[model samples]
Target chain A: MWQALYDEVKNEDFMIIAVAEESRGNETAKEWLDLAKPSYVTLIDREHHVADLYNMVNVPQAVWIDEHGRIVRPAETAGSHDAWRSMNREDMSMPEESTAIAAKAQKTYMDAVRDWAINGTMSKHAFNSAQVRTHLALPTENVALANTNFRLGFYLREHGQVEEGDKFLKIAVDLRPESWNLYRQAMNLREIGPNGFAANEDFFARVDALGAGRYYPPPNIEGFPTEAGFVPVS
Target chain B: MVTVLTEAGATEVVSAQATGDDLWFAKTDVTRATGWNLKPEGLCQGDLCVPVPKANSENFVREETVNIAGFWRLLGRPALHDQAGATWMLGASASDRANALQSLEAPDFKLPDLDGKLHSLSDYRGKRVFLTTWSSW
Candidate 1:
């Protein structure tokens, strides 16, 4: 999705910056990065600095900053149309419900992105200041604690203190069971090699456990006309 | 990776990144190391709320690294980061939640590219930027 966007806007003064929240240029992250070979800029956030900075609770969340450095759009789902449509149950071995969720998210996300690309702030897809502030996730007390515990646990695990790290990690997960990034990272620690996901708790299994109904917080593109296709919203 | 020294003991943290001025730890690491998380109410721990003064609220958080020095300062604890040694000595868990508000701009942070060169948000200040956060796992 980004590659195609990069191509379209290469002539324009637009930059697509991909921040790897937990990867930090590790082997598992590299495997996917190598495959994509993104022409755009890719930065590694080993400690999830970007996630905290943006209050991003999920991967592939996008924040659009205007040329003046103001946030034209707060972080929201930004999946590409191709990714959602290409998910094959037969080929990928994902459950029907998981794929359905992906498809739903990607369609809305891609349409909004494309509109923003063509129309810039004029795109109704972009939220106003009030809307942006209203939509951005406000960290609750539990969220804040969970974020802290997850960070500490992740650091301990990284420095060969698995037992200690797991204690905090468990607290983090238990604090915010819906935080997929935290849950996914914790599960992937025991996983070997640079494989993408494929952990003991697979993505779909976790999603199913969480119930596909609660998998993704609803896309925050409300009031932007969901059925408008690519039409600019004045 | 960076070294963290606490009263309990000295431990190395793999994810802490050092920028020139501040030793930044992710909110996760901050929670792990300091036991404070930025919540809607304030920088909070278990039933404890830390009041962050308004003056010190200027871009205290960059990227996602909470300013250990500033945070400790807010908590009125002495903290130091040895740049040359790449070490951070944390005093104690203070109520370091000064920059806990939601209206702040995303803090400027320098991160490494695939080749290990550092890049800052100021580098792309003039252009429309789409910052996407993701991971393989």
Candidate 2:
């Protein structure tokens, strides 16, 4: 999907740089990159460096930068919606209605990207500097501290201190509970119990707990859908 | 040995001393771990200098060693470590991050591709970039 969009806008001096935020390192992300066979640049980030720099709390977030290296848009949900929450756990299949909404959401996001790629600063989708700053999730003291603990945790785990690493990882999540990226990545590192289904159930339960919150924050782009079902799960 | 994690990667501060919440390092080790050096004026990096308060100088410096973690706190940056103080991670100050965002410049970072080739965000200057992040988990 990203490759197709890149192909459409590559002629406009536009490039897509996809980063896989995998704590388990290159091997964990290698298979997906190989399967995609992307022509665009694909890098693996083991330390969540990009997430820390961009103040991203979730995955599938994107930032738009212009020719001058200025951010035209701060990190936000790229094209995914929360429709997947409604997927049947047994079959992992989404309902037809949900699938249609998800597809529309993705198309809407892609069209906006194309506009910015072709029109540059003149594009309605491209935000001004002031707007970009307003949208940026500036890190607070706690957020910065959370990042430190996360980095230490990752380092400890990589260096063979799994028990100590888990402690710091837990502290990282506790410091910034709103950061699903931190929470989910930590969960992925934990030793799964014999009941493999426990992890999936825990994830969904957390999603369900966000009764009114969205999993994917609604994009502020013009014409982007914010209908009841389209306001991603938080 | 104290392990200090920075954007440049981890550095082992062999002569570091951890006392309670404070991590003290020799003047040279401070520079080696964090790139900030102590001088007659104050703690400095390049042309930038943060003058240590005359009255509270002891909080940052004691004889030949400087309290590295205290220096970070003095600069309004996060200085974090584990209970054992064996590891430390200094984070960017909130104001620095805010200033960068206010300037609208995308933060530059470098990460390796699957083939171990490094690419920096700044390398793609003079073009439009759609930087996106995802995870398998």
Candidate 3:
């Protein structure tokens, strides 16, 4: 857990940056950061500008920025190799005792970290310029459109002026209707905003159309796309 | 030199339209209910020429699952695809193709800490700050 890591690394020369338009007042984020005692920076982005800036499509994705403000690594929890991956197919399909592959991956990554901490740049796990570049590209056009609309819709519902964000959000629904985040956004927009767009039939129609016969909402929230247009079918 | 991502069903080549800078982008007539960007493959919006597979190759991607990493790969005109309901994503062919989504930054913001004081990025201008986001879910 990050709390554990914070206990370990919180006092070093480096600082901690918690990204999220996560908390509103100090009690939530500040309390934790203070408890950890690291020079911490708690940030919020209801508009997902950071997500857009770093191309972070997932939560807890992180990039290490060196002292000069240059990125040491693109944002992702490569550090999380220590943690068990939650969405393993084996776990999803059959969870009795098939963690063999997962264990191997964990050990490999752990060993890699030890190597990096000891020798730094000499570690094989350390990414080079080319490797890092290969890993930091954004989504394609279709995906980009989905991403753009989903984000636009999110901001519109949460912060921006009404109506315009919803229009784009509807297209997002049409694009990736399986996206729960998008669907949730649309619903929430209707629930809260100045638009007061009614819980229209068109919205449900979009959700129905998303998965069509196959779009099954994953039981685990983390496994689903946190984008627009995806409605939970049940 | 544009690239397109699409929900290219078995018959079509892409699902979504094409989007990028302007290098590989132009225009196309492939329009349906499926969402698509309107860019081309192999032209730089700047100096980047994102490629997209025309027909068959594009269908393969459309037929597959779309993940964050998968979407990032399909940036330029490199390759594309779509499925019936699943989101369509393309694969970028730029040798410099990096996964952009994984490296995004947290936006600048000012929120009151557990205390009543509002904290801003400007407050840390001269300092080195590391912010981490923790989630119970």
Best by TM-score: 2
Model 3 fnat?
0.21
* Candidate models: Cα lDDT each: 0.63, 0.84, 0.40
lDDT of 1 at A219: 60
Q: On residues A1-234, what C-alpha lDDT tens digit does candidate 2 reach at each position?
A: 689877877664788899988887775687778788999999999999999888899888999999999999999999878776778778778878888878888889999998888888999889987888778888888888788889989888888888999998999999998888898889877853333222467777777787766678778866666654633345
Estimate, for each residue in A65-177, the C-alpha lDDT of model 3 and write its tens digit. Answer: 43334454554543222112223323334222324433443344334433433444554555666666665545444545555565544444444445765776677667655
On lDDT, the leading prediction is 2
- Which residue pairs collide in model 1, if any? A148-B31, A151-B28, A151-B29, A152-B32, B52-B98
lDDT for predicted candidate 2 compared with the true structure: 0.84
Q: Write the per-residue lDDT of candidate 3 for residues B1-137, one digit (tens) a residue.
A: 11233222222333333333111211232333223433445322445443444554342233322222222345433232222222223322322223333333323445444434567544553333444444211
Model 1, A29-100: lDDT tens per residue? 777788899998898877566665566677878888877677777666666222232244345554465456
Which ranking of candidates, highest lDDT first?
2, 1, 3
Give the CA lDDT, 0 to 100, for residue A26 in model 1. Answer: 59
